[model samples]
Target: MGNIALINRRNFLKGSAIIGSVVVAGGFWRAAENGVFSTGKGPAYTAWETSPNGLDGLVNAALLAANAHNAQPWLFKLGNSSIELKADTGRNLGPVDPYLREMYISLGCALENLIIAAKENGYSPIITYFPDQQDINYIAKIDLTTMKPLHMELYDAIPKRHMNRGPYDTTRDITQEIIVSLMNLNIDNSEVKLFMFDSQQDKLKIGQAMIEATQTLISDKEQIGVDPKWTRQSWQDIEKYKDGITTDAQGLPTLTRMIAKILPPLSPEQNNQFWLNTLKNKHVATAAAFGFVTVRDPQDYLQVVKAGQLWQRLHLWATTKGLGMQIMNQLSERRDREVSLNLTPVFGEKLREILGTSEWHSIIQFRMGYPTIEALPSPRRPVKDVLVSI
Candidate 1:
């Protein structure tokens, strides 16, 4: 019981605060009173906490999942030997994530933690999505069955998984073996292609394309207005605001926020020039990038969640390999605006010619590399605030 209490308290401290703080050997930590309910303990549910780490461990770990702007928008309904993930729509980034794309990723992160912890506790989680959409918050139902947890190599990757936005070591070329490993993990029905631009010239072209996309989107009125609110300015601001993608999002520099906010939105000429410069400079930059593609005929709820699962595991795998990644999901972001961009030439002539329609090519993009500096932990809302009791 005392062991359970200690784990619970540690989780509360880590969840409500930041996971990065847990690094220090001896530090001020949050505590759980009454041995059951405490400040960071999630909502009261009827479930019996039977995991080796207890419900608190599972819930707190879920809370640690990184989300857009660090917006910890979720709630858990503890059930008999199970946990339910529901969206806290009130905290939704409605305009930018109108379709809750980022929300899906956030939920994926939580589900990833749950799956890992369940396995650690000798159980496999059964996941069902939107079993009830009448409740917008209800995301999924997880049933934990009694089964001996086999040691999964992927589980070892969980705690280390992080979004790496910085430049990677282009000199250290990625082997075909690693690429195959990544390819094999695509459990979803979606088709995934891994493109490696190992050459300096190819890297340059892709870099320029990415910069162009980022610059163009940044200036896009809809994007600027919608994305800025979610971008946290500094570590102090993260502690102050207490949620959303802080500067620590992807562990990128916080100053990027300041620069982003001050930059002028691109005009037509500027947008084109931005792409041109991106292409020119990308050729010289030192890093590796990858494109994650999905083939969802009509993007629906199930497809998105499955993409999340594949993405979550891939992300963890990258971390285990000592690689860092940051989602370059701009292509996915413009799924609805394909016609406006006339992306045929941009994506590739083959995609344009083969599909006969401007199908979304990349669902996600990521730059990989080891970081020069470590990221400070972003904040999450208190468990009491996130979880709702019946």
Candidate 2:
């Protein structure tokens, strides 16, 4: 009887070990399949490497442009010697961008890239904004003419520009010379103005405003709900959609990201809190300088688009300088939300105060500095997916 009992116990223990091993193996398999390890390698990123020429190449470069939420909310209509950039309103963040402000801005980012690529690929591009008054979505039409290939430093930085969400190296300060160079990118643009806040006092003021705005945003249930829809938590979704924010790009440590892949996804509330924490700890804390782009009227879509173009150009220039940049647009977003709801423009007022002027309206805000870690690229929809008929 004792010998039979001992054999049964051994068999049970062996079976349990097998199940544990299978479970552990299964978790790892899922992680690998879901892209817990892969950061920027996929069909989505092929455009960066292919480097095709002419209109097709222009579209490829446009796909790499920086946009809000990684929404990539713009479509291209290619012509023999032209390209039409259209806003994909359907992809707009619902409450987060009620005015379609960010949507138009995103289209502007794509437009900037298209123009840069066109210039680099031996074409002089002429842009006509709002080519069709009836269809606001028809954002811009670029007519291209053959020209000598103009190799620009900004054009070369196209594929290299990724938003760095990680903590910056606070020890390294951006020099005045670099700041002046960045400012020069927008020197000819009269509509959109760039402002920088590098002093400790100024950074603290803007950082506090950002935190307050983030809190306001997360508390709004509708905004919080809509925001998460664009966040791709699984590797399957990341590859499948090829657009939207991913955990790997969130600046979390590698170990934390791996563990997050194995663990259940965070609830919306938890995710909101996590964002708030990250903003306070990783982002705002380490920002060496904060800057914002402003226009005379925030409601002017054209001005907003120009602001985005300025941002893209500035970012590309910054990339060449080996600086990391992240868009800190929560305050601007909250301001949009306020306008949409007809609420008092609390955030708007704060922004104006920070800029120390009521004349210019803040369209976009960002921070830049030397980064402690490399920023990962977010998934992008290939040019093929974004091309539209007619």
Candidate 3:
């Protein structure tokens, strides 16, 4: 009896030990699968938390500006008292942005942030656009002079501003006062105009146009092929590249993001379909309002850049007002593609009809509202990576 009891006790102890080991292994697996070890940590995100003084700090702030596909496509040439902004054309979004319209707008965003940071750092920035007209890539030159530090509310919102791609709170409506304030953001700029669409009818019109444009864009073989190149699937890639869109920034529910991480990487078709579905179900359906930044000429790079600066300032202001915003530039993307291919301007016509204005060309469109979930910051290349020694 004693020997039997001893054998049973040993078996029970062995089973308990095995169960404990399994539990431990499962915990680690879950942690790794969810990217708990990486997500927003690392050199890519350090700029948001730190405030280095001078040119480096300005560059860091510029790095946080909203960009197409999270592609940080601007490089800096720091001078004794000037900072030159240049477009890194190599990072251009292939067929996705054939004309580099979005690219210049992205540089404009960076330029806006740099100017805001300069003011906050006690400098008056004198900006010269296309300092070297001979070099198209030479975007802007900002000559800074000492001044009493002028801190603006928009400057304080720089680090807090993020592109919210998740579903917004439909229950909360943005007020007319807030919308008017947003409209006033571009009142001083005659080249760029801001249009707001808040009525349910207008929202439906814009949402349908955006959905159709997205469908058309994803159907293009070249676009689909090139677009996925900007998506970072693994944590390793996210950290190593520190530039493209990641799962965490997709605005997926926490559990959904975790599940996606555990699964094998999605195929290009799957990714495209997922984007469309999310746009239809989460983004468009839940948006509280739609807005457009229209310019006198879409082909004019300077106007596009100014449009971008307005967008950056608008987004920062929105952030200060505790609002969430995401660019839904699919319609513009489709229009560009049509122009490139000399196809019928189906999307362009739609945009004009929605805006009720042929006088202004739409350069960018975005949705704004209160987000259901907090938006995470996309990874940014550090100042060191972007600085060019001139």
lDDT top scorer: 3
Error of 1 at 280 (Å): 8.8
Taking the candidates one at a time, how many backbone clashes does each contain?
13, 1, 0
Residue 198 of candidate 3: its Cα lDDT? Answer: 92
TM-scores for all candidates: the values are 0.70, 0.92, 0.92
TM-score of 3: 0.92
Every candidate's lDDT: 0.53, 0.80, 0.82
Better of 1 and 2 by TM-score: 2
Angstrom error of the Cα, residue 40, model 1: value is 18
Residue 294 error for model 2, in Å?
0.3
As a TM-score, model 2 comes out at 0.92
Better of 1 and 2 by lDDT: 2
Model 3 stretches with alpha carbons more than 4 Å out: 1-34
Ranked by lDDT from best down, the candidates are: 3, 2, 1
lDDT against true structure, model 1: 0.53
Per-residue lDDT over 1-390 for candidate 3, one digit per residue giving the tens place of the 0 to 100 score: 000000001113344444346447785565574464566778768877887787899999998988888788999999999999999988898887888988988999999999999999999999999888799899999999999999899999998998888899999998999998998888446889999999999999899999899888878888766656677777777777888878778776654555456556666666677777778887899999999999998888989999999999999999998899999888888888899999999998998999898999887899999988888877888889999997
